[model samples]
Target: MRELKPWLDLIFKRPGRLVVGGFLILATLLSGIALLAVSGWFITETALVGLLLAAGVAATINLYVPGGAIRFFAVSRTVFRYLERVYNHDTVLRLLTDIRVALFRRLSQASRIRRGELSGAQWLSRLTSDVDALDTLYLRLIAPAALAGLVTLAVVVLAAVLFDVGTALLVGLLLVIALLIATVGVYLRTWRLSARQSDRQEDLRTAVIEHIEGFPELTAAGRTGKHAAWLMRQAHQVTSEQAKADTRVGWHLAGSHLLVNLSAVVALWAGFALFQAGTVSGPVLVLLPIALLGLAEVYAMLPDAFGKLGATLASASRLNRDCREDKQPGTPKAAGLPPETALLAENISVKHSGYAPLFTRFNLEIESGERVGILGHSGSGKSSLADVLAGLLRHAHGSLARTDCVYLTQKTVLFEDTLRANLLLGSPEASDTELWGILEQMELAERFATEPDQLDTWLGSAGSRLSGGEARRVALARVLLNPAPLVILDEPFTGLDAETRGRVSKRMETLLEGKTVISLAHGSEALPGTDRVIYLSG
Candidate 1:
């Protein structure tokens, strides 16, 4: 229901769509009534061939009116559809923005949670599948079903007045009963299937994503065949679950079609009996079936309509649970250190349930215009401290100073875009001269110089085609272009060779002149000219 609220709220947000949607509903019903009129003209004017021809002409004109109404109906439907996409897309994007912000916030605060805690597969599932689930709100059943129902109601009432009122009432009642019974049955059957399908889809998505991400590792370990088999198994499970869901939906639609046809036959038979008994005239008898035609169509369509609505509601329920469960941790206190104060962390500690403590009373202070090296063994809290200082992590116990910093993590993150675009991310207004200087500083200028397009060269998905070291250098250059007052680098020198590392270290030293730098390192090799060392031992 909560997931549905956003979509519903969107409809009411723009008053024009609501009013236009209602107008379309009325036009749809009047079109259906025009169909009945055309049929009646055929039956009543049969005695005079010439007059019947004239009535046929008049019926044609009446029928033409329905077409115009239908045109308006189509126009309104198209406009409403456009409005819905514009509104819903913007709304979902906004929600995604919030989720992204929160995810980064949690990553900063939750020290014990490694990137591995939410594996690539899990993150992919959340970003793509879980986020995609919200489509049920706008793209599925609500608007069409509501419009169809209202139009059906108006047509039914019109038919009742035009034909024998008793028979019209009886057909409407039967339709209601038929719709209610079918809807409940379809809901129960599809509910279980849809839920299972959603679960299996997530499982398959997770497995496939993980398998792809771990491809290099699996190949190196000679376990490629094993990973392939595991992926196939997940695919099989997803297919089986999807098949079951589809089968259930198909059966429900088939049964609903059968019942609707049966009801139509019964209604026609009853009308015939009334005609024979002199209770209804021939024209009126013909009118009875004409009126019931709309009901027949409605009955046929209603089951699927209701089924999809049920699926959408189920998706909404899942979204609500996820949003509620993953609420952000405690609001972090704003960093208290003065803006000009380089960087400071006083007795910062982080502890988590069911995990080893990440940091214990860790303390560090850096004056502006200083280069400091943070050295520690693997898991000695170097990366974690960098995260805390950069406002990406929150320590349970600490007072940290505020300082502008550009953080570069170990995993060189880049969008599938041109080199210039990625570098421009930090400072879009940077001049070409500044960019070339930074590239030279990172010792990545040679690669750019050799490229056919230099800075404009396309770096495909996460810079996959580039060597690990090159990707790292490019990311570093991007941060350098940003020129933050403070820079926090984690394992920045890992992938570089000896000569390149030396050049980069020298450039970093010069760049840090009169600036504060906090770098996490495995050893002092990358420290070049830093004057201070903070060793943390866990």
Candidate 2:
């Protein structure tokens, strides 16, 4: 319950809509009850043809009464439903976006202060599964179920007041008690299971991503079967956990149904007794049972909604804790010093937390308008060094400061969108002409031109549709588009052929003529045009 406060606040942020949505829900529930009341009249007055006809006429009230009030209620409910969906999805996405920005910002600050935290998988989990779990909030589980429960109570109270207040109160009390017992039971059973299930699912997703990303290495080592088996084991584990959690959900549903039915039966017996005592007529007695039965169906859905809301609350709690505990260091404010020209590392060093030293007392400086090649033996901290320069890794042994730098990783990342979409990212205002020139400069105009839709061609899933070299070119194009004063390339020429590599090197040199360029390379001669070479040894 404590965990849900912040998330609840977001949903209720717009008090006007919150109130409007509340009223709309009330109308929807009342309409449903009204519709049921008409059905009851038809059922109880079957022998009276005229009365049945009158009930049918009253049923049309949904269509004609209250000056399109019925239609207004229906439309308002739908509009609120749509608004709820849009607002919730957008809010969850925004929270995730903020989290990603915060995580990266923390990583950047850690690098500045020489602290490297949060693995790629951990960060990825936060972005994907963690954010996904919060979906329960907006998916109507919280609001709709809560509204259903409240509306059910109100209907029972109204029925009691209209009929015999005592019997009505009895039915209402039974419903509330039964609902409370079932909900509490479900919460106890589902809380840990749901939370663990979410965690396992995240683990499964992380494993799948890692296995797929490392496919090449696994294949090279002739361990395809091993990797496949490992992945299968993770998948099975996740499935087993999910199945257990799903079984609990089944139990919750079944239990809720049992309580709902039991309460309806109790209400029926009470109404029959009232009819015998002459406190209620046979028709009213019969009508009470029908309404009670209808309310039971609404009751059954309550516990599951509560359980789902519990899970969502748990997820929100995790996100909140992460946000508060993992404080990101502050960057320079907008009014701070002007962007610097050169990137400087004064005796910089980094050590992994609970791991051996990755680097110690290393010093390097990249001046403005210089293309520096970084050459190092494998495990000689080459990638880590690139990470440092790129503002991805934080080291503690010395100071590293940068101005106007964009880092490109060894592994290329592209969205499942168009070439232009991936290049422009969130920059919607970027002109097509400016974008095409970048692609052309990266020697990728032919690839886009040959495609069926040109820039509109979907580069499916992390740019899987693009070849290794093509993806790199697209990534480089993104870097070029940054227009930053410094660019750090981490093994950017990895899978490219000789000719393409030569052309890329020349093009990069020309494009970044006045910018500081840091290229980490396995072979120093790869970038012959580089002004300086720093060969590092582990």
Each model's Cα RMSD:
5.3, 6.3
Backbone clashes in model 2, listed as residue pairs: 111-394, 114-395, 114-396
Clashes of 1: 4
User: Per-residue lDDT of 341-451 in model 2, one digit per residue for the tens?
Assistant: 377776877665677887777777666777888888778888877776665656657776767577788778888988888888624566888788788887898778888
Q: Measured by C-alpha RMSD in angstroms, how accurate is candidate 2?
A: 6.3
lDDT agreement of model 2 with the native: 0.67
In model 2, the number of clashes is 3
lDDT by residue for model 1 (196-261), tens = 667667677777777788889989999999889977887887788767766766676666556545
TM-score per prediction, in order, is 0.78, 0.74
* Span of ten consecutive residues with least summed lDDT in model 1: 323-332
Candidate 2, residue 38: how far the Cα is off, in Å: 3.3
| Model 1 accuracy (lDDT, Cα) | 0.65
Q: Which sections of candidate 2 miss by over 4 Å? A: 1-10, 14-25, 46-132, 138-140, 200-282, 307-326, 330-341, 365-367, 425-430, 450-452, 496-500
TM-score of 2: 0.74
